[model samples]
Target: MSSFPDYYKILNIPKNASTDDVKQAYRKESLKTHPDRLANASPQEKKTATEKFQAVADAYYVLSDSQRRREYDALYSTRSSSDKSDDPNASSTFFNTFANMFASAAGGPTGTTGDQRGQRPDADHVFGDVFEDLLRPEVESRVPWWAWLGAACGAGIGFIVANIPGVLVGAYAGNRLGAIRDAKGKSVAAVFSDLGGNQKAEILRALAMKVLGSAL
Candidate 1:
């Protein structure tokens, strides 16, 4: 019998992981397995990393969606219970099943052959965007108004206490402190977590539209 792929295991996450956990896991796994990270490695190493990257993306795609996760959990339970350990066609079987599941969910035709289904456009699409985004990292932080205030207050206090040198030192220290407190940067995973719901959906949708338009 064919076995379903354990997405939770693929992502190194628990089955009971929340959506945020799933997003964090994906970011972690994808970063580790990303193709660019293996650019200096051997061809075989690069190939292995690519496969792992693709698998991580696939797992994330399913587990990140509430409806898809529920459906996958049900099918996963059913298949895992009846699957034989020695099944040689497990990989192909699971690919077909997974493709069909997404197709059905998207209201797309599911009659495509295993080869066609296994050529996952959505996974490739996701991989492209993820790599591109990773290449151009973003930091969600800004210098708050209090930084200037802190600097001014520090300068005033220092000038009264000492002189020009004290004012300079005080202003520098105060500004640095305020900046450190207010301009706390988020990690890539945290950025991904923050980009949940509409922001993420809009990004993917915009990419899909662009791809479609380009193809046409």
Candidate 2:
């Protein structure tokens, strides 16, 4: 009737659906259409998912509130009847009332000059920065040439002679002696030692290759 969105249709719920039904539908739809779920999807797919997810959230926001829902229904009902007679004044009045109600609920506009409109921050830029940061590759600390030399000497002596105990003892001694500082002033050896499972293994492999190359 009104040019306003049909919140019920957006949420895929019947007009007579209870609050619980609305909540359930919102949860189901939100999870299925959430942008985060399409992280690895194509750009167009992610954009579409984000738009649908926002619509679902907006629909839920209005429908979940009794007062807002009542106001929305009343405004639309008036607009629906007025539309039968093609009244432009009624349509304009409905939009004005909706805007005023929304502004009031949002604590009114903050600017002085009696202007009802407020400047909104660019949401795309904010979210884009967040996603970029999340997707950015981790920068590994540069391994100092001196540290590599020390690790190389340790590895050659430890492994070249095929001494398993020497290798273990050398590693322990190197970990204790090699106290290179990272950008945060933390010990690099200690940081590497604290790494878990595959991460530690990968770093160890690189260190081994460096040492083996130096030995040859």
Candidate 3:
């Protein structure tokens, strides 16, 4: 499982977002994805809405607290982050359970899950600048705060642009249901690196389908 949930990405907030900003986002998102809003949607659509709702709640829970988030940062230090790389399937389930529990406790899903035990793991992404690479904060003779901000914004734009190709390819590949379906129930799981051969790639992909499932 990936160590971080790419909190900024999950919340659609800049790394520099203030506490108030985080709260605003949570409120907006809750209104948008509440189960009541999804009640009329199809089963699959409802599931999607619920997952997104969970994400919003998860993002809020982490960013709302101060002490817990700081401690979380100390534990999972890294140079970068990604929500996709993290196991969304697992994270979503955890959040749903938490949300449900909270709802039950608070007169409930209508309000929020009151029971914290089943809730998703506390926000672990806002730890002290884990995305060190994305926010250089200095470039020329130690750039000033304004310059650093520009660079951070520029880096974010560039990052999105850089990801377009991969996103397109993944989207295209996602259409091939048959290929994904065939690579299930594999016999092995092996971690591959740059030195991995074509055979290794095949084996790993096949195994991934089995273990992670195509849709998941």
Candidate 4:
């Protein structure tokens, strides 16, 4: 499971965003993703909108409070530099139940029951910097942020399920999906607008993975 939701990313603000910025982002995002705005859309679209609404609400709830936001930001920094051992949930030696609980809390799929847990022990370390390698500024000036975000998420989820093979496959799938969105010339905000609950769940997971790569 990931450490915490990437509130900064969810709100589309920088880590150094001001309180006013948080408030404005919340208002804008809430209005945009509010389920009421999608009443006439398909059931799936409505459900996705609802999930995004809740996720946004969750991000705002944590970020609006100065004390909580301070603590969350500390945890965010710690998780980036700490090794897998510092995080029992991210550790490869944890129990399936604990892993599942953290995974669920981290917005991972609920369909991971009966799946393998902690098989390789070192899978997370493998390809740890894949996102960093691909996301360098020289790669492309216009590649949206979510492209790397989705890729990091793919790798994080892969660590939880199939280990090494899962990481490779997940990264590829995430990259492919992001590529499709890129080809369509989607902006970061636009891509996020169409994402569902499962996709949003990966936000923090991707952030942690990304920060780790940068720290290394």
Supply candidate 2's per-residue lDDT for 70: 83
Model 1 ranges with Cα > 4 A deviation: 80-93, 106-124, 127-216
Model 4 per-residue lDDT tens digits across residues 1-216: 444456677778988898878866765565555555553589988777656655565556556657556756666676553332222223223233223333323333211223453122121222222222222233342756666777889998987889999898788767755655655566445655666653444443344434442210
Candidate 2 residue 68 Cα shift, in angstroms, is 0.4
Candidate with maximal TM-score: 1
The alpha-carbon RMSD values of the candidates against the true structure, listed in the order shown, are: 15.7, 18.3, 19.1, 19.5
Question: Ranking under TM-score, best-scoring first?
Answer: 1, 3, 2, 4
How many clashes does the backbone of model 3 have? 8
lDDT of 2: 0.50
Q: What tens digits encode model 1's per-residue C-alpha lDDT throughout 34-151?
A: 6665436899887776677667766777787787789878877776444522121343346555656665354432212243433343545665554344324332236555457668
Q: Any runs in candidate 4 off by more than 4 Å, and if so which?
A: 81-216
| Highest lDDT model number | 1
Clashing pairs in 3: 73-127, 102-112, 102-113, 102-114, 103-108, 103-109, 103-112, 103-113
Error of 3 at 203 (Å): 53
Clash-forming residue pairs, model 1: none
> Candidates' lDDT values, in order?
0.59, 0.50, 0.44, 0.52
Over 62-158, each residue of candidate 2 has an lDDT whose tens digit, in order, gives 5666766787677556544334321223233333345456655644322112445322212233222222222122443375443455455666687
Indicate the residue-level lDDT of 162 in model 3: 63
TM-score on alpha carbons, each prediction: 0.49, 0.40, 0.40, 0.37
